[model samples]
Target: MIYRADPARYDAMQYRHSGKSGLKLPVISLGLWQNFGGTRDYPSAMEILGHAFDAGVTHFDLANNYGPPPGSAEELFGQVLARDFRPYRDELIVSTKAGYYMWPGPYGEFGSRKYLTASLDQSLKRMGLDYVDIFYSHRYDPNTPLEETMSALAQAVRSGKALYVGISSYPEQETREAHRILAEMGIGTTIHQPSYSILNRWIEDDKTIDACGELGIGVIAFSPLAQGVLSGKYNQGMAEGTRGADPRGSLRASHIEPRVLAAVDKLGAIARSRGQSMVQLALSWVLRRKEMTSALVGVRTLEQLKDNLGVLNNLELTADEIAAIDEASRDGLMELHPRPSGWLR
Candidate 1:
């Protein structure tokens, strides 16, 4: 069947500029970090991608080591792009990253110029693209000189392998330095990808969010549901096939502590009051900040994608609701009792 994108795709969705860059991304972006890998079902993946694009989710985020086998997610997305989205290519914002153990070699995993340059080439090849919209250093390499990493990213822009460059999971100071280094090289740092959710607030505590806002770098939050913990899925307990139940998954059983579940329950109650699902509430909370340019969601099924998209129906949260959320989060409550509301404070 011929795949034509819905004509109304752009009508309901919202777009925000990536930091000070001219590029604008959808308020909600789809991430191929999981479920689009080799082990997943192909037709199902195609349906999800098609549905997402139809609903105006123009940004699709990927990384070199995203798949369990590495590089498979890009391969999968590449196939879908060719078969379904060839004509609408210009309408999409496709991004990928490198900076993990992509291969077993000394130069395979860091922010070195050699690794970043090579990884971008491999990623472009795997995605069957002339250039990606954004290329990111997946993580900050403590051992690599910051200049070296930013230089590699600058080269990507100069060589036209990527339209923009970004950093993921970098510390506050490193993010500032990266922007400075890239600017000196005549390139603007476009976006910052970080793990942010109701449960994971490290970016806030560490002031990375503040730094991005000050630097004019957009923030796209990954795991805004805290790897599905904020979805109220683990409230009852870890199900058989949930991420927490999978030992190899990033969301471990230990992450869903009793206190955390208690917090989620409180959050769920707030969601119900707002006539929203836990997923919708979680996403809305992440997007509440002006600095949050997008919430990057990874969904396993089309139904889950629909549920996530429903968040757009009620994107705004009242100030009192925000305060309630802060009180309920309990700072993920490491202590036996709840702490003062940091957000309210």
Candidate 2:
């Protein structure tokens, strides 16, 4: 049965401006990155998507290489759009990204003008849409000039294929250059997606958040849950079949170190007192940043989606609470990426 979103949904979900744009996006956005592609549950994906919208999550984030087969997540979401969400397209803030290893050959990926343009076309075809609400360069390619990639994104807006453009995982310096280049083209960046959470705070030193705020660009922190580490799920060790167990899922296994588990246990206890799950605490923690535009989260089930939405209701963290969190999770991300000067891999 086709489900309709609750009309009162907007009453409960918090909204934030997309930088200086007229748009006001939900404080929490959904991203289809890891488990929404091949070998994942499409029905659960649809359920999560539907539940997200019904709970006032209007923004959906995706990328070109977000599937087991790469590009399958967009195709899967396109199927959902065609089957259940065709009429509500205008009500949704859909975004997709390029600039990673998508297709073979030199021209198929990276921040080059040719790759970005072609990738958007392919992404649009996959999503069954003429235009996405926002398109992004996905990453910063050191080899490609900022002007070249920025120009392609600007052209996407002018050509009516993308309403706004953003960048992801860009270093602070590169992001500043990108904003300048896009401004020269008369198109301001609408958003930036960074990895930020209690366990991963790259933006702290990068100053990208302040940069975006100054440039009138929105900031959406992806992996705000630290890829589920902040969820209190790994305290007893990763479940028999979970992110740590899957070869495709393993990226930073040190995330579950003994100290990390102990910290999560303490955080989880505090969350229990607040009558919220650790996931909710993590989500709320990210929302505590006034400079944060949105929290782009990933989910594997409808229950997870529902659990995360509760973050909006009890977001008022006391100053001491914030201090406790800071004290508990000190320098969590620094150890994960010991080499700050090295490229993100």
Pairs clashing within candidate 2? none
Q: Residue 264 error for model 2, in Å? A: 1.5
lDDT of 2 by residue, 221-253 (tens): 887887788987887666865687676573466
Error of 1 at 59 (Å): 0.1
* Model 2 lDDT on a 0 to 1 scale: 0.83
What's the distance in Å from true for residue 74, model 1? 0.4
Give the TM-score comparing model 2 with the true structure, all chains together.
0.95
TM-score (all chains, Cα) for each model? 0.95, 0.95
lDDT of each: 0.88, 0.83
Winning candidate number (TM-score): 1
Worst 10 residues of 1 by lDDT: 336-345
